[model samples]
Target: MSRPTFKRILLKLSGEVLMGQGQYGIDPETCDRVASEVKAIVDSGVELCMVVGGGNIFRGLAGAAQGFDRASADYMGMLATVMNALAMQNALEKAGVDTRVQSAIPMASVCEPYIRRRAQRHMEKGRVVLFAAGTGLPFFTTDTTAALRAAEMGCDALFKGTSVDGVYDADPKKVPTARRYDELSYDRVLADNLKVMDASAVALCRDSDIPIVVFSIRDEGNLAAVVGGEGTATIVRKPQA
Candidate 1:
């Protein structure tokens, strides 16, 4: 199969990825490693942006289940994402990559508020933009935010960097025989209830005609390899007629 080339892409990272081998919170070394990988991508000339999840610090749904109001819990989750974004920004800057953090919730004291045109300009200037706060709304996951931002930025693809290499028919960790898909149609993924991403996020990408690439970020150099279409990953998009 021929590789799909992308001029621009949005990377969606779960907060747990920054935890390294620890049980919780961000790990500085993990952030630096991810930053190095991102620097390589940016230096390779791919316009990149990112949305980091906050599940590691405080999952809104989990908090809601523990007695917090759903809205309040979700807001806390959003703040956690902002913290993750700042950590990533620091790592990227330390690695010599110009970076910007924008929050939908508009914490001007810390980072810039998200502005579409301004973000576009940042990418045009070869800077990486980290979008935080998940749409400034309750009841939405960072997966949905990643899809929305990818569409808004006219990204060529949405790259979901997770612990697993690709989408599996079952949880790969629990099911040793789980089948991994190299490519799947958006309809197939949706109908099968595949865990490539949140249903809303997958649907948005489908509507926008943007492909979602699911791959492992834990492995060094996987991001670049996947971006070049030479790594173990799954591509979800509309099927060719």
Candidate 2:
């Protein structure tokens, strides 16, 4: 299959990815490696935006299960994302990549608040924009934020970089025979209960007519290869008529 050229893309990274070999928290070396991968894409002329999750630090659902109020737990998760964003910003800057961190929750002292036009300007000026804090509200995942931001920023696609290389019919780790899909449709994903992303995020991307590229960030240099359509991944979008 041919890969569609994406001039602009929003890369969604899970917080777990930053954990590296540890059980929790961000690893500086991991952040640096990811930053270098991002820099490669930016240097290759792709306008980049990013959204990183906070599961490694604080998970809203887990906190709620342990007795914390759902909203408050989610707020904590949002703060965790801010920390991750700052770490990423530092790494990107050290790599000589112009980067900005925009928070949905508006902590003016730490980073700039989310402004569509301002973000667009940053990308136009060849700077990478890191969107943090998950829509500044409770009950939303960074997945949804990535989708929403991708649409709002007029990004051509949403690149979901996870541990697995692509979407599969079942848990590949548990089910050794699980089938990996080269492509998928939004409706099929929802109908089949595929865990490529959360339902709301999938629906939003579907509604916005934006494709979601699921690929592995664990493989060094894979992001650049996937963006160039030479690496393994699953492209989820509307089925061709």
Candidate 3:
């Protein structure tokens, strides 16, 4: 099945998922599974870009809120993301998918610096590009980085690969009666203050006219399923019939 929804997509993954059953750090099994899902998506012929979050290693915002220097903590967070990105790149390549790691902070010895043209070119050439470094600034979340990269790369939609299947009226874990939405408008998300992502990221995506598809990355084969129009996630976009 082919999704009538999107063509090229930017997949945003939280590094915590790569930690598997552990509290932190990359678990090889989890990375392999993630890589397998990614392989399936590439096999479907959909051009893809990736953005990774560093929560598994460190959360700069959380530290800053707890009295840590915002800039220094954020820099550590960026470095954490780079580590996660490199791990993911290694996994993907092991799974036989050509992948590139691009960092917003210049690190030519390790990965290429974030370059719009280069990323686009990589996707055009059937390579998956992993964007790291969280906008190369402190006080910005990876969610915003995803939206920014999606808009800049001309992605058809942004796919947030989370643990939950989709956005809910309340935290599904806490509220058994929480209602799951199959589809929603960006305006509705904003008005209701839904928690799919940070407000800045949602606002940026809305302004850029980018639809966001939220789904569980841990689900086996879900990535390919979503790209094939069989996802059981929520689609947030401009109003449509």
Give one clash count per candidate, in the order shown.
0, 0, 0
Candidate 2 residues 6-30, lDDT tens each?
9999999999999998999999999
Global lDDT of each candidate = 0.96, 0.94, 0.90
Please write out the lDDT profile of model 3 over residues 131-231, one tens digit for every residue: 99989998888999999999999998999999899899999999999999988888899889998888889989999989899999888888787767787
Residue pairs whose backbone atoms clash in candidate 2: none
TM-score of 3: 0.96
Tell me the tens digit of each residue's lDDT in model 1 across 1-241. 5559799999999999999999999999999999999999999999999999998899999999999999999999999999999999999999999999999998889999999999999999999999999999999999999999999999999999999999999999999999999889999999999978899999999999999999999999999999987988999988876
Q: Each model's TM-score?
A: 0.99, 0.99, 0.96
Which has the higher TM-score value, candidate number 2 or candidate number 3? 2
Task: Report each candidate's C-alpha RMSD, comma-separated, in the order given.
Answer: 0.7, 0.7, 1.6
10 residues in a row with least lDDT, candidate 1: 1-10
lDDT of 3 at 228: 74
Better of 2 and 3 by lDDT: 2
Q: List pairs with backbone clashes in candidate 3.
A: none
